[model samples]
Target chain A: MRKLLPYPILSLSLLVLWLLLQQSLAIGQILLGAVIAVLAARAFAALEPQQPRARKLGSIFKLAALVIVDVMRSNLAVASIVLRDRHRQQTAGFVVMPLTLRDRSGLAILACIITATPGSAWLEYDSVRGTVLIHVLDLVDEATWVDTIKNRYERLLLEIFQ
Target chain B: MSEVPVWVAALVGGLSILGAAFTLLGCIGLARFNSFYARVHAPTLGTSLGSIAILLASAIYFTVSAQRPAVHEVLILVFISITTPVTLMLLARAALYRDRAESSGDVPLQWGEDIVVERADAPSEG
Candidate 1:
């Protein structure tokens, strides 16, 4: 089984993706997708990427829900800022914050969360200093932004990935 | 199809309109924002909720009209949610690198350097 499927979860997800793209569950399509999935998994294994150990399914779900809610709220906030406060003096600036979540996958997920939400963009990460730079569209309070990232996202990500 | 229920039709119409409005707002933000860093945030409005809303509408419309679950729209959502951040991060980093190369005082000095550009609108330190 290990020889046939080096990465079971990756192969399974790839198979599901293939079936979804094909939009069919016929035997022939299943066979073809299975073959492709195994082959793709093998190809990925050859690359020898670092395997990320993600745990705490409950935390993952909570993080996902929080991200969705935050994204929607920021969408409205940014839209109103752009439309209503266009004339007002907006304080847009870069925020520098230190992060304790050292796991690579955790950092990547954090980057995605920061960038996907409107009004904030992840700019850079300094690995040596364990700090990240993010640009906020509405920079009302730098400490608040830092607190949000550390408490809201990083804490959950640490729980899951670390 | 014409046989779609009134509620379904209404839901789809509302979702599409909401998505389009959000996308339009994002475009307006892109044009209105002064700096590159700020402009980088504008399109996220379209990519995040805007794309999800439209994709949800498409999924629902197809599911109802075909009488089968048409959830392939979710694949698009997953792909968009994953790819948008990568592209946006790259763009933002590239812009920052260019600004730094030109010695623009708008951005910070370097990764570890703590020289923040002070602006009139910056909140005063307590």
Candidate 2:
């Protein structure tokens, strides 16, 4: 049973995604999607990526709400900056911050969150040092940016993925 | 056009226009930013909320007019949301690698942190 469904959650989501793409709940489509999802799960298993464990499911919701709000706010901020021709006034630079979250999946999630936000780009991660290098646009203060990453995303990710 | 309801059509138009505006802003930022690192951030304006707005508009318009659940648009949303960051991440890393290899003064001379490269002998954790 374990071998057949090595990633039950992934398989289920992929199946739902497949059915959504099909845009139908017909019986035949459901069976076909299930088969395809199982196959995809096997392929993912073959790739041997690190398995991520979630310690707390509730934290996921909190993170999602936070990201949605942050993304919306930053989008408006960035759009206005571009419109006002203020891009030239601002300075952008790199800041590397130490991270305690060693889980690879947590780091990937952090990378997505940082890059998805308009002002910061996750440039590199140093696994040896548990630090990530990020490039910040409109970098008013380095300490502020570092503190935000640490307090906002890193702390939540550590709770969820670690 | 006559067959379509006015309010739904208006919603689609408004959302599309907003999406286009965001995309335009992001491109402008890309062009205007001072350096590569800074420019990397510019596209998020278009890809994140911008993509969401456009996709939502499309989903709403199609469902209301076609009289079928148009939630299939959610797949595009999921795909775009998942892939954009990966693509941007790769681009940023490639730029950093090139800069570091050339010893360019624009970026840090030494990143100082070491990432443990996955090796064949290492046990794969899943």
Candidate 3:
């Protein structure tokens, strides 16, 4: 079993992806998908990527829910800023915030979250300084951004990843 | 497609229009924003909820019309959500590097200068 399915979760996801893409569930398609999934999983295992362990399933769900709500709220806020607040003075600037979550997967997820939201962009991460540079579209208070990232996302990410 | 219920049709229509409007606004923001970093954030409006809304509409339309689950659109959603950030991050980093090399005052100078000092001090702290 270990030899055939080195990465069980990866193989399962690949199989599901194949089935979804094919939009079929015939026995023949299932057999073919299984073959491809195993082969693909083996290939991926050869890459030796760092495996991320998600320790808290509940935290993961919580993070997803929080991200969705925040994204929706920011979508409206940014839309207003773009449409109605054009005349007002907007302070758009870069924010440098320190982060404690060091897991590569967590950092990657954080980058995705920051960039996916309408108002913020992940510019750079300084590994040596353990800090990230973010660009805010409507920068009101830098401390608020820092607090949001640290308290809301980073803490949950640490719980799940670390 | 023709036999879709009124509510389903309304929902799909509303979602499609919302998605298109958001995408259009994102493009407008892209063009209107003054700076590179600010402009980088514009398309995310389209990529995030815009794409999701459109994909959801497609899924619902197909599912209702065909009388079967047509959730393959979710693959597109997952792919877009994962890939957009990577491309945007790369673009932002490349822009930052170019701006720094040119000594453009638009971005913070500390990014370029502070890395060296931090790296030099790392051994002593350890």
Candidate 4:
């Protein structure tokens, strides 16, 4: 069962995505989608990276909700910048953040959370130093940004992905 | 196929235009940023908020026009949101490797040998 659907959840989601994009469920389409999913799963299995173990699914959902709210807020903020440009605020610079979370998966999730937000991006991570480099689109406060990332995203990711 | 309402059409057109504009902004950022590390942040604008606006517009237009729930676009939104960081991480790692090999001053050169390097100029390609 595992071999056939090495990544069972991923395969199923891919199949759904295929159907959604095509907007059809013909037998031929189903077969082709299945084939593609299987091939993609096989490719994934070949990577053999350490699988992420989720400790609390609730934490993940909570994190997602928080991210959604933040993204929406940032979207409006950025849209305003685009819309009104009398005396534009330039928000492009590098910030170094000290991190407490050590789990690889948690750190990876934090990276995604930061990148997915419109106003900030994850630049790099130094494992030995346990620090992260980020670029902010509207970097008004450095300490606040650090606290937001470390407390908001990293803490929750540690609970979930770690 | 009936004549679309002006208000609805205008809303859709506006949202679509906003999405396109954000995407272009992202691309311009991608081009303008100096270093690879700096350039990494630019595309998130397009992949994240930019795509979301477009996806929202799509979902709204289809749901209203077709007179049904047309939220399938959320799938793409989710996919891109999840995958963009993963791809970016891989590219960053590859770039780091190349930078390290070239003995670039900006990147850290002395790290553990855990990452397998296939060639010297790998980072430049990414």
- Where in model 4 is the C-alpha error above 4 Å? A79-91, B1-7, B21-43, B63-72, B83-126
Better of 3 and 4 by lDDT: 3
Model 4, range B1-126, lDDT digits (tens) per residue? 545678878887888888888888777656665567656666777887789888888888887888877878998888898898878767866776787788684654433444546455478887
Model 4 chain A weakest lDDT span, ten residues long: A80-89
- Where is model 2 more than 4 Å wrong at Cα? B112-126
Cα-based TM-score, every candidate: 0.93, 0.90, 0.93, 0.72
Compose the digit string of candidate 2's lDDT tens values, residues B57-119.
Answer: 989888887888789878888888888889999998888889889868578644432323344
Candidate 3 error regions (>4 Å): A85-89, B110-126
Interface RMSD of each: 1.0, 1.1, 1.1, 3.6
Query: What's the true lDDT of residue B36 in model 2?
Result: 83
Give residue B73's lDDT in candidate 1 (0 to 100): 96
When only the first chain is scored, the TM-scores of the models are 0.96, 0.93, 0.95, 0.85
lDDT tens per residue, model 1, A25-98: 99999999999999999999899899999999999999999999999999999998889666563689989999
Displacement of the residue A68 alpha carbon in candidate 2, Å: 0.9
For all candidates, the clash counts are 0, 2, 0, 0
Clashing pairs in 4: none
Give the Cα error of residue B100 in candidate 2, in Å: 1.9
For B89-111, candidate 1 gives per-residue lDDT tens digits of 99999988998989885888784
Go through the candidates in order and give each one's DockQ.
0.70, 0.63, 0.68, 0.25
Q: What are the per-residue Cα lDDT tens digits for candidate 2 across A1-162?
A: 999999999999999998998888999999999999999999999999877788887899999999999999999987776766653646778898898988888888999988888988888887876788888877889899999889999899999986
Model 1 chain B poorest ten-residue lDDT run: B112-121
Give the C-alpha lDDT of model 4: 0.76
Model 3 chain A weakest 10-residue run by lDDT: A81-90
Docking tier of model 4: it is acceptable
